[model samples]
Target: MQKFSFNRRLVIIIVCLIVSFALMTVSVAVRNKRSTPPLIQQFGNDIVGLTDRIVALPANGLSGSVSSISELLNTYQENQQLKKQVGELAQTKVRDQTLAKENKQLKQQIKLNDSLTDYSAISAAVITRTPSSWQNQVVINKGSSAGVVKNMPVMSGSGLVGRVAEVNKTNSKVELITDNNDSANRFAVQITTKSGKTVNGVLSGFNANSGQITMNNITTKAKISKGDKVVTSGLGGVTPKGLYVGQVAKASGDDYGLSTKLYITPATDLSDLNIVTVAVTKQ
Candidate 1:
């Protein structure tokens, strides 16, 4: 009887296994014939997509805001730079206009192709000036080939500017009267007082701060006053006589009252020289 019971239990176990296999096959076939996934799986996918959009919305907006702010800052900087350039361009234009007007007036005042008493003038343009000695020297387009020689007096549209310091085949260097060096040449200048008295002095140095030349060695008793016209005395054989030098601005006695010192405002605007004349004494 125990042996029969054992065989019956084994058969029951084999029937249960067959029933589980048949159910698994039927479930697989039903899933494959459906057009869409089960409802629970579809709901889970929708939840995942919604969560992704909700998380990315603020992040994308923040990225766009940052890009706009960066572009605005760059544009502001570029606009400021452009404004500065425009301002500079405007200033340059005004300066150029002023220079052109001055140049035209200077040319008219010079009276080209004219002679000054015993000397004939040669017109020349200022070619260059070195920064190292800008107040003391300038280079002219005229040279030895154009009858320019050392110690020859140079004049501007208004009056005397300098003298030829060095001469080359094509160009020459002019030593301005503003030079204050120890070895600088002096001009023998005379002033015509209001009463027609002539007061003589030596133009020795330049006061750079005042933009005036200093004249010394005048007699303390000379009757010199402001606005008196000064001219070359021709005492120095190199520079010709009767060249207009400047006007006396001030006159004062030196220390100990031994001699008089006169400050002269130059006849020409020596600072800005464009066209100049080389006075070549007629042979």
Candidate 2:
């Protein structure tokens, strides 16, 4: 009986709270219904007056319109920037295509020249050259895979350049005629004698600054002079005949044990060998 009484009292309290809340809501609504219509009517009239004044051009909405104008100006600026970028991209693409075409044409020329060459020369590009010193040597873009071997004769259109000394994968080294190696094993060349009649001395490498050749073991009785031509004799099976070495730049020093000293210059410009052809077959 006591539990039933406690439950009934708790239910009564909840019912009372709900009834009070509903009465408060009804009182607020009745007050608003009586006072709100006049306020609404007055606000509508004031909005109409302001809009008419603005349309007549006697009032300014500067502050209200500035944000909209700023947004429009930003949009215009963005569109202009986009147009400029498109133009620049188009111009750059055209320039890139032109450069690519020109580069292809130049490579074709190099390939054609290589094809017509006498020696069995593979195509290669010179990546770099030495500095200061007479770049009597250059590194080519060929190696053992390309049939490049040691002591292969290398040449250009003007004349013989040098021989291959070192070969590696995708690269090879060309030692020019004026290098230290060629000087040691000097060739007593009989040149295409345009310089002079008394030009029958072997040419060897000399100090570059001296700008001369050391022709040793010259027969003392031979009539040798300055500005004479020196060329290969096709003798040692090293260099073939008719390849011009250098003009007899000058003759210097007294007679050695059994040879006279004849100084000479090389025919091919060793310092400036750009493109060269290498004969794979060692002659």
Candidate 3:
């Protein structure tokens, strides 16, 4: 009787398993993703209407949460595009600025060439500088090969900057008036102000190390005051006439002899120099 009862239980379990397997198979067959044509055809009109509604939804400036999500994604993509465009614009701006600087420099060279038509202009670049010496000096690109010889005066649009101190075939050294050995700065300079008072003074380096030059040696006969302009005297024929040197800051002279005092300001800001013109051949 026990063996018969066990066999009956086993039979019942087998029947349950078979039924579950059939149900599973049927469920899988019904839920298969292969064919949706029956449902689509049954609700074709509804599907079309829903599709129109989805297509008509505004992604921006909408009040619904779904619309908000869409707007955010759109805004994010737009921001990324703007950032890329801005980066490209920044690069273009840098290139334009560099080109502008070069153009300005070239225009200046042309102007210098136009101003001095008698002499030939050799375009030389500044290779080195020495500010520690009493006279300031700079090496240029042109040398004996370029026909740039020693003692050739270097001038800018403003006036004389210095002279050629050293030279080789492809290079030359320029001695600025601010150098210790340079004699152009040691002589007396004369300034005729707008008021017509002629002020006489010596121009020299302000310090042992600095390139700060000043107009000293004021004459006693001259009525000197602050803010007076100083210029070259054309005495030694080193630098040409009427080059701006400095402005008078203070004045001190003897009662009968020449007056001498310190000049407070420099006419030119030496630090801002980028381009300068040198006279290769001069009369």
Candidate 4:
């Protein structure tokens, strides 16, 4: 019976609080009609605004982070595409340069063919060079099957380079004029003078350090000059006539001081040999 009386008193107190809050809300609404909202209402609105900002803070931050991540991904994709394009451009440049170089080499071969009109030529590519200090030999792609025989003269774009030393079915080795061990490196060369007289000599030795060939056994009565053009004299049955050797650079006495020696700067640059032609005579 005592608990029932306490519960009845609690309910009466809650009813009285509810009636007091209703009277306060009615009074504020009537004052708002006369002018602006009262200070208490403005205070309530400010509190609601503060609560809304607090609620939205985490949502706004998350939105900004997502947007930044999306933009970063897009930038990365664009960067990758640009890198691929740059790689393709580099490859294209290399291809173009290679083609241009090949074209130039072909043109040179054509010019060489026209210059040697007297003899039939067999074009061959240099396979490899001998790995020696003298650089005295090179292997070519043509051999016995292509009519390339031992002692056959070989010429590059500039002039005579060497002669065939060994031959096989599909390849041959050319012994350059600078070879020290080759006994057959000697050539009968002649220089024509301004007066149409020819001076004969033997091209037998080469000085690697000076890049010059020594022409010894020059006849004492022969007249030659520094700028005279030296060529094969066609004395030996192997080499044909009129093949260019070099220009006379200097003249000095031989080691025995008995005969004259002419030093010649070779017409061909032996350092580089890409393509060559072998003179195939009718013999």
The lDDT values for all models are: 0.75, 0.59, 0.58, 0.75
Q: Write the per-residue lDDT of candidate 2 for residues 188-218, one digit (tens) a residue.
A: 4773444344334555556577755566666
Model 2 worst lDDT window (10 residues): 112-121
C-alpha root-mean-square deviation, candidate 4: 41.8
Q: Per-residue error at 220 for model 4, in Å? A: 3.2
Candidate 3 segments whose C-alpha is farther than 4 A from its true place: 1-123, 130-135, 144-149, 156-160, 181-188, 199-202, 208-211, 253-258
- Name the regions of candidate 2 deviating beyond 4 angstroms: 1-124, 130-136, 181-185, 191-202, 253-258, 279-283
Q: State in Å the error of residue 176, model 1.
A: 0.9
The positional error of residue 64 in candidate 1, measured at the CA in angstroms, is 52
RMSD in order of candidates: 39.1, 38.7, 35.3, 41.8
Relative to the unseen true structure, what is the C-alpha lDDT of residue 34 in candidate 1, on a scale of 0 to 100? 42
* Position 90, candidate 1: lDDT: 99
Q: TM-score rank, highest first? A: 1, 4, 2, 3
Which window of ten consecutive residues has the lowest lDDT sum in model 1? 29-38
- Give me candidate 4's TM-score against the actual structure: 0.57
Prediction 3 TM-score vs. true: 0.45
RMSD of 2: 38.7
Q: Candidate 4 at 184: error in angstroms?
A: 3.8
Better of 3 and 4 by lDDT: 4
Per-residue lDDT of candidate 1, residues 102-190 (tens digit): 76677679964323335778898765565785347876766666887677788897677787766655566688998775545677777
